[model samples]
Target: MSPAKAPAKPVRILLAKVGLDGHDRGVKVVARALRDAGYEVIYTGLRQTPEMVVDAALQEDAQVIGLSLHSGAHMTLFPAVVSELKKKNATDIIVFGGGIIPDDDVEELKKQGVAELFTPGTPLQDIVEWLRKRFPSS
Candidate 1:
């Protein structure tokens, strides 16, 4: 019989609250959930600019970038984040978002390359499962 294969490393995710959004209770909860689920989470507190978010993700070598938005700036903020990631040649990182984003904007954000949207009330396990499937390291 062949030797057993080793389990893959947990995905590293950077969770950020960008563009002056001061309410981070949701992001904090999700960050803890991701950590408990075995992901290495780098939480970039509140009021981060898009550039800062990308920089931190790059510095941390994160495989995923999760943005928590609630300031009604998803339209401007998400695109700005994506654009900065492109400029830095870091577009390979899977980008996801969750917040009070409207349905139309969620579609538009997905079209702009957001991997998924975790709206209010989304189960925490759903996010973890999605990441594990999308970024399995084994």
Candidate 2:
């Protein structure tokens, strides 16, 4: 008799900060939480452009691309990243955002394929749980 094998682990994720967003305390917290939740998180440093973020995600072979934007440039940045990913034919990557984003922009960001948006004071456990369901922890 043969034993059944376990399923492969879910895809890894990249947590990045795009643009000149100096405030990274929240991003750091979430990164630690995600790592503790069993995801291989690639944390890109601050002031990255959309192209750079996408490039890092691609190079890291990440499945989930999370952007932490506090610079209020998300209106130009998030969509640009998404569009660049599309241009690169990277369709399987899931994107999300977190930061000091307004309510209206959050909806628009979702419409543009951001899976979810998290503002300040969002619980790290909640974000981790969401990733667990969305990407599944090994």
Judged by TM-score, which candidate is best?
A: 1
* Residues 13-93, model 2: lDDT tens digits: 888888887888888888888877667778888888989988998999999898998878988899998999999999689
Estimate TM-scores for all models: 0.91, 0.89
Clashing residue pairs, backbone N/CA/C < 3 A, model 1 = none
Candidate 1 local accuracy as lDDT? Answer: 0.89
Candidate 1 TM-score, true structure as reference: 0.91
Each candidate's lDDT (Cα)? 0.89, 0.84
RMSD of each: 3.9, 4.4
- Residue 85 lDDT, candidate 2, scale 0-100: 93
